[model samples]
Target: MSTQARPGWMEKPRPVTQVGKAIALVVVVALVCVPFLTILSTSLASQGEVVENGGWVLWPTEPTLDAYRDILNGGIVTHALGVSIGVTAVGTTLSLLCTVFLAYALARPNVYGSKPVLLLVLFTFLFPPGMIPSFLVVKELGLLDSYASLVLPVLVNVFNLVVLRGFFQGIPEELYEAARLDGAGDLRILWTIVLPLSKAALAVVGLFYAVAYWNSWFYASLYMESDHWPLQQVLRTYVVAGEGLTDTTTGEGTVSAPQTVQMAVLVIATVPILIVYPFLQKYFTKGVLTGAIKS
Candidate 1:
């Protein structure tokens, strides 16, 4: 076919427009990457190097793991890391289980009060419970200064529940019928059939739960004592609140630059999400689109 006779859809974008898009993309990438680079570089930079560079280093002349080593060695950050890992692990598990069960129940066609229950859940999204009220409830429940305080209050995110429910509802009804004909119970069907097929949705939802638990700081600050604070809360204390590491350190050897330690904490707080995201990213779009579209 002649080039002129090709369909409009087949035609390439104008060269100038392509150039403009490339430039725009580069700008966006740089906007994101520059700060991250600076943080990483500054974290790796020695105290003297940071001082010489006037507080921020875009590139370290000689990178060192001293900051990381110092932070991880029996300090406030170390304890906070342990707390964050524990909370994220336990919270994500409980949240995923509760969300999945609730979503599955709601997704069923003839479940008693399903509509009312779903509506009630959705209503919370529209008018979320006030923080004070939530706190009071937690306190009344005797969760204050308890790790359970962080997880229990925010156990099932309405949006994640909706996504999971939609995905469950999208499963073909014939499968349920077939399982029932084979004398399979609801739990069996879920374990042997629904869960296996819904891996994408599960992965995506699980990632969401994990990220929420990982990034959570405010709840820990409110509900837990200082000793039980998570990594993000400790990050907030030292990095965001401009609290120096003097009090945080275990009175070890010479402390690194405050900026380096701060950036190291920032990097540590950020790294888990970055490490996790790529693995689940491939499923995120597919799962969300499939659930949303099919349901």
Candidate 2:
């Protein structure tokens, strides 16, 4: 076929179409970046600058780290930060381990009860237990008012489990047979063959668990005492509830304007995820697409 005789859809984009795409890309970037910039600028802005700008400083005339200093100076925010870190670290590790183990088991061929267990897992995903039922279960387990409550209730996410299971099942059965002939058991096969091949899925699932643990607040409010609240819940109190930081909340903090304090807290909460995302960005598309659709 002649090049000029090709269908219109096969041709390069027209100039107008290219221009429209470029404009759309810029608009999307602005929509994502502008809010973050505003937040960072407002957080760094001087009290006078923030006040003059009517609670928003898109470009601080004189940037200062006073808000961060106040938050980190032996404050409630600092403690909450510690709690969030500990919870996220411990929760992600445990959740990932449990998910990986369960997924591998379910993915194995002709495993006893694997089909029923998988069906049960999917059923839970489709019809999750309600808040009240979950609360009662937690209470029965005597996990309320404990950090374990946060981790135990959501240790294995169904979507992550399903993704991992799908990925594991996609591994070559020839590899399994070879491992077995070499005297490798399930654990050995999982460690030496399956895991090394499945790093992409693991990375994505780990990020999901980490983010979930880090950002969770509703469960904290339900199960934990105020003194044990995580950073997200504490930030909710300061920003959504419009509360001032007390002496106990932030030792030596002389309540800056709500905007500055809230923005600073937001930055602290967000920076960790931003820092970690780049490390795993390369794995996201591979993991999600392959895991979700490979089978």
Candidate 3:
């Protein structure tokens, strides 16, 4: 075979192809940006403006942060924010610890019962517990109505564990042999060797855990009281039941249309993910690809 590139691959596209590609890109951008703009504008606009403009605004005539202030002024919405932050932080940390320990153990060679344990883990991944059984288990464990209900049942995500295990297995055996020669035990080897090299995978898995915990509301609904509901569950009520929140901006305490308050809540719930994702984006591809290739 000639060591030349294919002519078609190197050739510039015709004008028609270029135009079509540009059009497609523009359409995709508009589809995403338009809805985001409408929600943001609606949230910033006054309740009267939102109501008068049919629940969505492309641009607010006069933007105000009243809706945001209302939510952050130490009410249920504020409390829910606290609950969500706490749960995401604590849950992600615990999940990462448990997953790292388990994945490291499974990745090692000739460990007692490793195969059966790995098989059992994969079996759960394939056959997975149903909602009813999971609920019953949570209830029986006296986990209902507590924060543990949110974290414990879903901790150590099977996919994340498998990904970490695969990533760990890809480490060269020579490194392990060297660590053993230095009289470093498994814990020391893992701490000083495996973990430092697996930063990308750890970052990816931690991001996964954070996002999952932050976005979870179903479990909160099932196991928590209304007052204990996280931001998503509380926002769900606003979006689903069409309930209105009081406009704290006005001294008269007027009730705002659900759209502004609802959109504000949605934006708040969404912002943390937006902020955190960029930091981890650079690691995402390598981490996922390494695990996938190993598998």
- Backbone clashes under 3 angstroms, per model: 0, 1, 0
Q: In model 1, which regions exceed 4 Å deviation?
A: 1-9, 246-257, 290-295
For residue 10, model 1's alpha carbon misses the true position, in angstroms, by 3.3
Instruction: Tell me the tens digit of each residue's lDDT in model 1 across 1-295.
Output: 1346667778665788878888999999999999999999999999789988899999999999888987888888998999999999999999999999999999887678888998899899899879899989999999999999989999999888888888888889999999999999988998999999899999999998999999999999898988889999988877777765654454643344378888999999999988988899999897788656754
lDDT by candidate, in order shown: 0.88, 0.89, 0.88
The residue-by-residue lDDT of candidate 2 on 129-239, one tens digit each, is 898999999999999999999999999998899889999988999999998999999999999899999999999999999999999999999999988989999889878
> Over all chains combined, what TM-score does candidate 1 have?
0.92
Better of 2 and 3 by TM-score: 2
**Top model number, lDDT:** 2
If candidate 3 were superposed on the true structure by all CA atoms, what would the RMSD be?
3.7
Candidate 2 local Cα displacement, residue 204, angstroms:
0.3
Question: What is the alpha-carbon lDDT for the whole of candidate 2?
Answer: 0.89
> Which stretches of candidate 3 lie above 4 Å from their native place?
1-9, 244-257
C-alpha lDDT (0 to 100) for residue 104 of candidate 3: 95
Alpha carbon deviation, residue 63, candidate 1 (Å) = 1.1
Residues 27-103, model 3: lDDT tens digits: 99999888877888888999889889887888899998888887788877898999999999999999999999999
